[model samples]
Target: MIIESKVIQGKKLIFNFRSAKKEDASNLSVLRLKIDEETEFLDREPGENFLSPLDFEKLIYEDSISEKNIFLVAEIDDKLVGFARLQGNNLSRFRHKAEFGICILKDYWGFGIGNSMLESILMVADSNGIEKVSLYVVETNTKAIELYEKYGFKREGLLEKDRIHKDGKYYNTVLMGRLANKLKSQ
Candidate 1:
């Protein structure tokens, strides 16, 4: 599922969001690590489950051809700054649901990049007949939680002690889901 590139004008900054290209593999490899290390909200540690360039190449290539998946990248001046993915299941039991994930660099926060990514993902999900879109967020991520809720996601449940943060204390995870619908704009 290829998304047409969209140029979003934030309050000040402007950036492009588009389908991940094969050449973006190396940058996506590094972007993932930087985002994970910069924030504890994501599940992975900096180097855990690290995917090399070749690994990303393969994954992106596969995602490029998969009808049930989409990998979108956000860029400014040709530099990758963030990414999001919507992964749908092929099995009959879970074909109507998809999982969504997004990561933006700290420098790019507060620029409506997340809103664009999410709107695009939901568009794809709705077009594909994906009735349910789900995501997991750290319980402490109030800003993100608010954004999800603003977009119609409802808290489904909580996973207690789901993550052990840098402070050596366990934190809960919020499971959220939204039924697919037309894209909403702010």
Candidate 2:
């Protein structure tokens, strides 16, 4: 099934959200590297020495099992600027839920791109019979936490010292989730 696309305008950007294609691997890889370099929450940095094009194609495109995963890309005038992914848990007990993650170029933050991507994902999850969607955000990312809350995701739990950043500081990661029934009622 084709996911519907949407556009949101900001002071300087016209963000477009659409399903990611195989051809988008290269551009998406670049965007991922750039975003990783700018954010401390990501597990690793994708620097000049990292991010092979072949690896991107294999992981993001060729090996993707679309039935259990949905990949979305955000573009501006044909340039890939961000990406969001939803993947279901493999185990039977957790199969009703999906995990989500999104990253936008630092320049694109605050332009509503993140919110749009998230809303789109939630819609997709709801239509696909996904009962719950979950994500983890570093405690310091107040903006993201607020946005998640606005989208009906409540704080589920905290993973104390879940991650250690490059700055030599440990940060807690907060888990949040929302149920499809609750979203529909809203």
Candidate 3:
């Protein structure tokens, strides 16, 4: 699905948000590794579970064809800086829900990129018949937790020892979800 592109003005910086395309595979491959390297907040280690351009291309293609899934990217000056994805389930029992995940370059963390992306994805997901969105955040990430709350996601539960960080400490994961407040009609 094609998403209308929009510019988000951040704290002295601006970026474009749009649906990811096949050509974005290479840049996304590099950016994903960089994002993972920059923080322990994400699930993957820097190089672990790495996705090659082909792998990303496949995902990009699948997302493009899937009505319930979306792959969005953020860029500045034509350079890809961040991305987010909404993955929907196949089974009828879980088809109304999707899992959301996002990542940005560490240098662009506070520029409202994440906030805008979340809002955009949610709006699109609702229009596509997704009634609920879910995500998991590391417990220590107060900034993320606050952002999620501000967007209407409530803490559903906690998974103790969900992650073991680089510092060799166990970290819990906060499970959060939000039901569609207003479903958009196509």
Candidate 4:
């Protein structure tokens, strides 16, 4: 389930995008908290993430074996900076779809990492027989919404006050989706 690494050059730095490895568990665990602390666009707050490195290792192992799952990471000089996941349900009725999520260190926000990761996930999803990929984004994340739209994902619905942040404010979440055939038509 390893995707070939693609080297990306941004204005300030360069990085590689590849599938996450078991050896990366510790790094991924720490990076997850760092990125979560850096953005409100993520579902969790700074200290809310409780997944241990062992948990990440287990998840990585599971993803490697399932055609329906994908976990990718962005590495710069061996440092993990960003990651994305496409998680599919094994239930018969839900097998055709997967839930997508992604996060990047705030310092690397505009380096096209998110764009590359989305393309990678979609490509893998298509190959794995996933017909639909869906995700929920904070209503205020216009940049992310624009990126998803560019990739043929359409806004489907809105959940009012779905997330209560550390700032003591309720924010709406926008549900978006992309279909395999839908992208082909586009």
Query: Poorest 10 consecutive residues of model 4 by lDDT?
Result: 177-186
lDDT of 3 by residue, 111-140 (tens): 899999899888887798889899999999
lDDT of the candidates, in the order given: 0.91, 0.81, 0.92, 0.90
Q: List the residue pairs that clash in candidate 1.
A: none
- The worst-scoring run of ten residues by lDDT in candidate 3 lies at 177-186
- Name the regions of candidate 1 deviating beyond 4 angstroms: 182-186
lDDT of model 2 at position 40:
82
Off by over 4 Å in 4: 182-186
Q: Cα RMSD (Å) between model 3 and the true structure?
A: 2.5
Across 33-96, the per-residue lDDT of candidate 4 in tens digits comes to 8887788998887868577899999999999888899899998898899999989989999999
- The clash count for each model shown is 0, 0, 0, 0
lDDT of 2 by residue, 94-160 (tens): 8889999998888888888888889888887888888899999999999999999998999999999
Report the CA-based lDDT of candidate 3 relative to the real structure.
0.92
Task: Go through the candidates in order and give the C-alpha RMSD of each one to the true structure.
Answer: 2.9, 2.8, 2.5, 1.7
What TM-score does candidate 1 get on C-alpha atoms? 0.95
lDDT of candidate 4 vs native? Answer: 0.90
